[model samples]
Target chain A: MSDKPESLTQADESALMQLREEIDRLDTEILALISKRANCAMKVAEVKMKASGNAGAVFYRPEREAQVLTSVMDRNPGPLGNEDMAKLFREIMSACLALEKPMEVAYLGPEGTFTQQAALKHFGQWVKTKPMPAIDEVFREVEAGACNYGVVPVENSSEGIVNHTLDTFITSNIKICGEVELRIHHHLLAGPNTKHDKISRIYSHQQSLAQCRKWLDAHMPHAERIAVSSNAEAAKRVQGEWNSAAIAGELAASLYDLEIVESKIEDSPDNSTRFLIIGTEQVGPSSEDKTSLVVSMRNEPGALYHLLKPFNEFGVDMTRLETRPSMTGNWTYVFFIDFAGHCEDESAIKVINAIRETAVDVKVLGSYPKGVL
Target chain B: MSDKPESLTQADESALMQLREEIDRLDTEILALISKRANCAMKVAEVKMKASGNAGAVFYRPEREAQVLTSVMDRNPGPLGNEDMAKLFREIMSACLALEKPMEVAYLGPEGTFTQQAALKHFGQWVKTKPMPAIDEVFREVEAGACNYGVVPVENSSEGIVNHTLDTFITSNIKICGEVELRIHHHLLAGPNTKHDKISRIYSHQQSLAQCRKWLDAHMPHAERIAVSSNAEAAKRVQGEWNSAAIAGELAASLYDLEIVESKIEDSPDNSTRFLIIGTEQVGPSSEDKTSLVVSMRNEPGALYHLLKPFNEFGVDMTRLETRPSMTGNWTYVFFIDFAGHCEDESAIKVINAIRETAVDVKVLGSYPKGVL
Candidate 1:
């Protein structure tokens, strides 16, 4: 939406106005379609609730949602990329899902954290998100039916794995329902009253400080860098300090009424974090799916090798394998593994069975769609 | 060491005093032994410099240090556990190594981060630690030979992998020299002047707040929780706020002059983070070692399955496998894999060669000693 060009002739201006009007008309039709979709979703909830006697009707079908997203991207002949097109549909579908059932998602948060962002991105802004103090609390909130689902950080491209999340899975019966990945962008922000040249201090989380080290060193060499707990808190601190600025995100900038001093200051452009959507009920297979499993192995020589052989034999694509010390044995370890395909698939079933032959225990976490956005 | 028991008789008191004297005498002998070790280290450095014509004298040998630490634990007839005994010798070796060459280490830091703790834990307190604001800076500092080694957080048990660290490896030539794991403990702290009943706000990094959710819910539910950038920053913020408390670590508490209101308040007892030591030089094989590799594969139907076949066939214990989008390709992925045994091992070599037969490219990140603490 560019402003009317000053060099445009009267005829061209009239043509531009007509184009704008046409866009407005298309927007109206789009709004009507969205309303129709929402109404259709409410009917879906009614049918589901009535069919299940209003007991435990699972409105959120991972496979179904994945199918919808896949079709949206596949069918899109867009001016935008497939990902951008799918994301627009993602929000539409999320709103529709909420109409079917208002999802209360518990996320690891104090608000404005990357995990919260992932929750909204996955569930859409319509679902109510409650900030839980810890990963396990998010699990407990969902387990106790206080929330329908939970979102927690599972891995980062840089960080290996969230050990606590994996550990929680070992003891808790919570199932992995879905997944989302969020690109992390850190911005340098300050209060409006602060003079850019006079800024003497910078506040950010330790990782943020590290992520933006070169930028800070080159741009604000004199500022005393203060590592805070969260970027949101750093933005909060800057609100009360004239000589201080914050390294945070757009969310925190708006949340704390801060101005962006410098944007996208992270050292690596590829920095992104992956979050897991967890719930009690199992997720059905999506078009492109991934299955998570926790396998415990006795402390025998070549234990890890034996546990992974099934995937190689069955041509199953293994995505991730993280080792954690098992709680039950002296020197035993458990492997948190993620492999392609749903558990119900023949190859996946065969692989799991084969792993179980040598493994002390093999617990299927869940099979969920691979992240759409 | 404990004080004399209150009910001790005259003879018992004398025996206790004698034991204390003996301990004091042993400590003096230990000091002499440490001094002797330092002198030996200095001599070793001199010999290395002379042999290499002072062009490059590698004073710090990861494998050698690992061997020493292993022997220390193995020979320990301990009232202390193997880990505790090894830690004591770790500090001793650190001091001795410092005497050989004053190693300057760079780490992701704003001074009081867990990353700094991991750096100190891995390198010992004797080396001068320089806090770099970013992970890549830590890598660059080492790469540029500004620092002897660099430490960065590779993963958190609760949060997963640090993507920037891994991404940096793809473009940078920094070597993984060693690995260390630190158990994370979050404490509720406040300024000395802050009244316990008047803690209207609680500050911490988002992760810490999540980690300590249960403790806060049970203890201070009414307080407003604020997420900051780092726990140290939270501790720093609480120093001037009479009505605020911060959840941080012991380092943050002392660094910011805060009093601990509660200790070890994380939701999960197993909360920990793993850090990587990056340097310019390759490390030789240690008794217990792990090799890291970055393998890029073509976008094939069963690319992941084919990659794992070698590890399975060679009976290599695959510990970790993380997938990241390839930088050069639209849909291709690069796997950051970790497995038991050094690159020099016969099985590891066979596996690497087998993988090379099918994989587009494989880059050996490093083979380093597994974390001892």
Candidate 2:
């Protein structure tokens, strides 16, 4: 493919071809802008290191990220929605962050799990991500300072909450530094040797299995349904046998070089999952931010009212609140809350202090920028 | 296995055998009690049928079920925890309910998904559970009167929220009648014909794959990781293959009759998921109740603050408050909330009325009993 624009024949100069030339010119400009942004990121890293007085510097800034994304959405004059535009910028920032410092992330994984997809989505492909089998190990690796940060699924719109991640915060001091949201789409896949009509078994993760329950029952009611660790693993298994198929996502389908027998097989068209970023230090305020905390209270009338009154009085917006069985004692309960505004915000601080006054104990999980994409 | 009272010499009876006899007697007594309970349920059904003026009647009572579970916990005096005691009673209550009217439940499934286990855990095996492929279909079946209720996952503690279920509620008028929490434990499984020493591939759901990433990296670093729909499906595929293993739960391993090469292989010890029950009618007050709702507000600063002020003023304790992207429009947001009392309660009514006064629109999902098991 030659880069020279040597030909301008009459046919090549048609209106459609002329429009294509403009599109190609715009693409060239976009690439140049990206390269320039990367160089700027390197300079930004240098400034951060000089300010911190060391080569080992904290270059990632959650507040700044929030501000950037919010600004992009606020000013977008586009055919695309704010979320779509923000997603495009998200990749740009991810690449820039890689230049500043290649982030090392630990996530619950076997390479093809949704958690891994979340890691890549949040940090981009530039980060070095290690998959830990358990959520606790992700916390451990982050806790031991082996990884810069850890990613864990905190909730699913369909599934409710991941108690393990919340429970981890009860015993560990990891900060909630960022958040990611992933759209869950399941696919029915098979290997090269498989006989499509003779497929006798299908495998997938529990959530995926549930997501595709309708499709499977209609197409392969008699096939053995097996719940595996991840969709990627299922795709791998089908490779060895002729009568097996897997229901996984795009990653797994590609990871195993499998064929997609069916796509978008999940029951809900809008299935999505939210994940959290955990680290040691707390984050500051952004244009819009969310702070999470866990609070415990004794069983009594108005106990919950007492815990929430301060936020109401302080006019702090509550984003999410959930109850979990208290790990410390019987007949005791704990609540996990997420609200708009960083913990460093004045109103949030007041509400937090007020909660501490009535709560048996309170842990400020962290304040992070809202999920922009 | 003959049960006969044989002569036992003073020194002939071992402590274990003596204790076993006592346990056997208790079990017999328990069976008698259960039989009596079942008979009472039959009489209750007859009364309900008479009251309804026919043999056909709706027998499941979410409020009454909650009250019974609460009472069981209150009166429990044993070495076992309240939760443990309530679990045993949950099954008993489920059995009794079956005698009155067998319940039919729809869940996201392929037989061995966690949602299936949750359905059984909440309703007991006496109820007929139809595995539907999608969360929406579960709602559809219940709405169409094909099933008494639908059990769809609303959230997971570790995973945060299930967006599809929440969004479905936005469109469909299903009431949240009850909830169930399940502890998730994953295991490594293999078929009998597999060569244990030379495993080159692994299969599992994406989440489970991530959950066991570290273990696999350490043990089988070279094995190709594959993602699947469900662990049960993975196990099924492994049954016919010799060089593969699946990571799934105990249910899948048993259902597929696979050998457990590793048990409790998940990294986190307390990974659990929470699920919600959806039905047509709103449940009344229970011994321990939680009410869920949805409210929309205008896009403005402190929109969330205005919505929560009433709950605080009325002294209503909100158990949960989550923000959802409004399905109706851009920039507008909605909140899903769970609180301490039924909508019929005095304080809760005040809060609801106050919220209605300012909010653009509101929908009360339901008020049901807190999960006792």
Q: Candidate 1 clash total?
A: 28
Which stretches in model 2 have alpha-carbon errors above 4 Å? A1-12, A24-28, A79-81, A157-159, A186-267, B1-373
> Which stretches of model 1 miss by more than 4 angstroms?
A1-373, B1-8, B186-267
| Model 2 alpha-carbon miss at residue B250, Å | 24
lDDT for predicted candidate 2 compared with the true structure: 0.74
Each model's C-alpha lDDT?
A: 0.77, 0.74
Scored against the true structure, residue B373 in model 2 reaches a CA lDDT of 77
lDDT of 2 at A64: 64
Over A69-178, each residue of candidate 1 has an lDDT whose tens digit, in order, gives 68666654433345644554555566667656778999986544678768877876557887676789999999999999999999853234677898999999999989
What does candidate 2's lDDT look like per residue over A1-373, in tens digits? 0111223335433532444344334333333344444555665555555544654466676666666667667765543345644544555566567766778999986544678768877775457777676899999999998999999998854345788889999999889999999887778889867888999998887777888888888888999999887766888898887899998766566557687788788888978999999988787677778889899998879999998899899999997889998988986789999999988788998999999888899899998888877
* i-RMSD of model 2 (Å, 1 decimal): 35.5
